[model samples]
Target: MPKRNTGRRHSVSADQIQKYLQEWFDLDNKAKYNKRFKRYLNYRDILTILFDRFPDLKTAYELKEKYIFFNRNTSLEEAEKGLAGLILEFGDSGIEEYHEFYNLLINWNKEIINSFTIINSRRINNSFIESRNNQIERLIYNAYGYTNSKRAKNRIMYCLNKKDSYTM
Candidate 1:
């Protein structure tokens, strides 16, 4: 019988967890699904829609200038707050669907703000997390076949261990 490794223990800041969750959300099939067409939104269409809806506004442009001038050192909270304000200002419709969408956008903005706070204060680098993700993908490819639950557990263990051993 092959012995199962219990896996390494590691600590991750809440920001890192939130970032991972956000990436998972972005990659999820359900999130990409377009109910209207019964199809998934491809990357190009997603970018187009986002750009159309949130076109370059004067305030956002100014923020970008400030960010660039300051060498991209703006606080995440400030950036998120500005984004939430812009979305609320431009997308606010009294209609139910639009209202729900706006609220969801605001919630995401808040999540980003919180995540940035945790990440900036932490002692971890994002490259470590990304490398762990790559490792998990390789493992999945190598395994060929495994229960979904088992794969998920293995991926999580790999991420934790990678984060623990990585320094940056």
Candidate 2:
């Protein structure tokens, strides 16, 4: 198997476990059953054995998946309660790593909860504004030493109103 650029090197079994776990837990993996291929079958066998051998790892993995599920499925009204329940689970989990994550979540509780707010059926975010700012900065850099303010304004408006525009 080819190595992934995961920053840290892992043993073959560790890499296999990571790969299988991601494939299994991927939100976009809509297939009800995995492909009946030899490679996938081997990975499944390895994961089954690993899960049986290390129940704590299994529990941690399940808890990690719970957050992903919650984020995708919960409504804005349900988000606060759902996240609180997750935080409680993380606090009670025996895993030391989760306890650290629990503290981090607690520290950013308000901001994380606020991120669940939806407006006009879309999640509220600053991406459009940030992108516009970046575009303006690039234009300004490219148009350095320009004395024509009106022409610069027109250029900015023209560039920002293209077919693939993200403007409001």
Candidate 3:
């Protein structure tokens, strides 16, 4: 018989769980499903997880505010410093462990910020293109809302080839 591969499943850390909750909330707010109630359910899940993780109201509020502030205005380096400071203040670990946690926090922060920046930049460009496409669609609909397929194809071809005809 062949030996079984017995690798353990990787466990998610509390910090990662918190970050995932934030991302879930951001995505859920913009998504529409069968009904409007789906977003509320997602919101409730986020709240439940947060409350379970940090039962103390004060600590939870502080953590929420810190995350929001950093997410909105602070850079990745600043956020990493804030996280490291919090860990140093509250964690009951030795120096080596603390250092490890600090390094992890910094790396995670950098990764999140870099990913967010790239995604956000793409979203901005996509939004602009969507807006322009909407305008083009409206114009086409107004001019030939019920035209035959062949005529519509001709119109699109003319629109595309118009600019190329006048190249200097």
Q: 28 in model 1: Cα distance from truth in Å? A: 37
> Candidate 3 regions off by >4 Å?
1-55, 86-107, 116-168
Best-fitting candidate, scored by TM-score: 2
lDDT, candidate 1, equals: 0.57
Task: Show the colliding residue pairs in model 3.
Answer: none
| TM-score of candidate 3 on Cα atoms, chains taken together | 0.26
Worst lDDT 10-window in candidate 1 = 63-72
lDDT of 3 by residue, 80-139 (tens): 666556555434333343456556655675454453343544511256668657655755
TM-score of every model versus the real structure: 0.32, 0.53, 0.26
lDDT by residue for model 2 over 3-104, one digit each (tens)? Answer: 533334456797899899898766554434345533433444656767899998888989999999997888878888998999999988889888889998
lDDT of 1 at 129: 71
lDDT of 2 at 99: 84
Candidate number that wins on TM-score, 1 or 3? 1
